[model samples]
Target: MSEILTITTDEVVPDREAVFEHQGIPAGRAVAAEIEALCTAAMEVFRQAAAPAGVLAEISKADFATLYKGDGQNEDATPVDEIYPRAKHLALFAVTVGEEVSRRIADGFKSKDFVDACMLDSVASASAERAVEIVQQRFLERATARSPAATKGEHRRLAGVPTGETPVPQFSSRAEKILDISSTGGDRRSPVDGVLAYSPGYCGWDISGQRKLFEFLKPETVGISLGESCLMQPLKSVSGVFIIGPKAIHLFDNCYSFCGRCTTHNCRDRIRALDAGG
Candidate 1:
């Protein structure tokens, strides 16, 4: 039997209080504790999935941060232009197993021997893929249901694009430099394949359109791919016509897709200012 190795975010990143404050969310020690528990529980599921594959080891938070950092020294360091400055806190979880088990897990669905041998048996016999899917679904549902003290209005102001004096340009000329190294032309790729060009703006005249655009652009606008699955499969996928509009950064993790113009008074005021200026 493989030993279960469970590691908490505390082992990798600093406490959750700092992360929450960095995002401009109200800080509560109690709430932060609850959030940490939730993260641990979510990681537990991944640990269980790795049981049959062998002992699982997760990447350290410091390493993960460097991987996603915009200007880190890592070869795959996320580009500065692609980095969502507003999203300084990233909670990432990954699993690593032995080479033999890794091959079995990868080919499990196709080969019955591998499936029966390396599949996670703790919760009914399940392939690694299915086990991962179940965990992701549960995680997302819980995250979506949780209510924070910060209102949508508050979040927008904190993450809002500057308009006074000289608005800091979100996309710098270095975007081209970043794109030269990336696969796509720095286009915002959809999580779902072939479904290019979705704008809440095109669908309606309301803030929903603006919100959709924002979510699409918030991530470090990587190139779009057709039917590309995210690190977490079934939970996240990428698709066609990647257009990184202004709002994709916030939506990347929060999954809160609501129009800033509709809900955020400050955002509405900013839009009016721009309109008047135009």
Candidate 2:
């Protein structure tokens, strides 16, 4: 049986207004309030998507453990306390925007500095929304892919496809070839070219190593090549090591292959270890 999963949503504080003002934008309380509303709405969608199928449960601070499985080995792995002291399911929180927000920001852009900061914030917001959407879609895909095909007059299987079977249709040879190249290990190169060339949306990098890479590329520039397919979202900048549960960690690791042309050898090793049950 699938375990019950709980999801909670909350606003990320220290309002983006300060950041906006720092960039010379006239961000008053009104702007901050709107940003918070947008974040809350996006998070609600995320929370709804994350809950176990057909189990309507209220997500709150008390139930965070159900959603965020902590790292099995160390306290640092599941530092939900540090990441979301107010609530568990939320690991990192920040305000971000969609196309609508971007247009608004663009409308407010006055000078070069203002334009630059506004653009950066817009990218960050959009990126967050994209991240949430990608994660939710992945969950849906896995659940659906694992579900068995419906047999006419057969019992409805709500738990989704069974494990250890071919749940989805076979990939074409071309797709398999792309998957193989994308899944290659031990390289820290950008996987954008491969993923964009073969699949839709940009892929994620290893969380542990991405900070440095993000610093190198900067959030504003990271998704530029992907155009409308992948949006750049800025994660809250924070320090301290954080680790998720083994399963979640494994998921994040495998996602590296989706990155298309990554050069991080460690990520490949992690994927191999997970596959081997190490």
Q: Over the full model, what C-alpha lDDT does candidate 2 score relative to the true structure?
A: 0.29
> What count of clashes does model 2 give?
22
When summed lDDT is taken over every stretch of 10 residues in candidate 1, the lowest stretch is 192-201
lDDT of 1 by residue, 121-185 (tens): 21121233233233233333343345222332333333342322221244222221211112234
Question: In model 1, what lDDT does residue 3 have?
Answer: 22
Q: Least lDDT summed over 10 consecutive residues: which range in candidate 2?
A: 191-200
Candidate 1 has a TM-score of 0.25
Q: Would you estimate the TM-scores of all the predictions?
A: 0.25, 0.22
- In model 1, the number of clashes is 21
